[model samples]
Target: MDGVILNVVTWSDMYYLDTWGRRQFMILGAVVMSICMLIVGMLSRTEGRPAYDPTLYKVNFDFANIVSAGTAVLALRYLYVASFAIS
Candidate 1:
């Protein structure tokens, strides 16, 4: 996902830079990446959380905080890579 996003962004980034300029893209990427990373970081600080209910619960991502957090982190990671690559 990281590689793919990076590669895809790289191809179009030149156009974006040409059209919008690097300063704006850099700032946009920086802001997006910072927000993403901050969310992921906050999520990481919370560990050992139960994903299921105390009753009639099964181990699953659907009921777990990790599901959202993990997804957020994965998304953030991709954004981070893309932003880094773009700049």
Candidate 2:
């Protein structure tokens, strides 16, 4: 997903770059990517819980929460990659 997003954005960036201008595009991309990074970091942090379960050898969390968080993190990462590619 990340690779696909990055490739698509990189390929189409010329159109957006021309419309937004270099400085605006860079600033917008940086801000969006930075926000995504912050949210991803918060969601993936292991400070409160060891993300990996020692006994089960998998993520140590409720199945639904883990699935949702993983999805969110993946999406955010993809967004960050696309943003950087465009910038």
Winner by lDDT = 2
RMSD of 2: 4.5
Worst 10 residues of 2 by lDDT: 44-53
Top of the candidates by TM-score: 2
Off by over 4 Å in 1: 47-65
How high is the CA lDDT of each candidate model?
0.72, 0.78
| Clash count for each candidate, listed in order shown | 1, 0
Q: Per-residue CA lDDT of candidate 2, range 5-45, in tens?
A: 88889889988778768998798899999999898778767
Q: Please provide, for model 1 over 1-87, each residue's C-alpha lDDT reduced to its tens digit, 9 standing for 90 to 100.
A: 777888898998887688878788888878877887787666666642536655866643331545766777677788788887787
Give per-model TM-scores: 0.67, 0.72
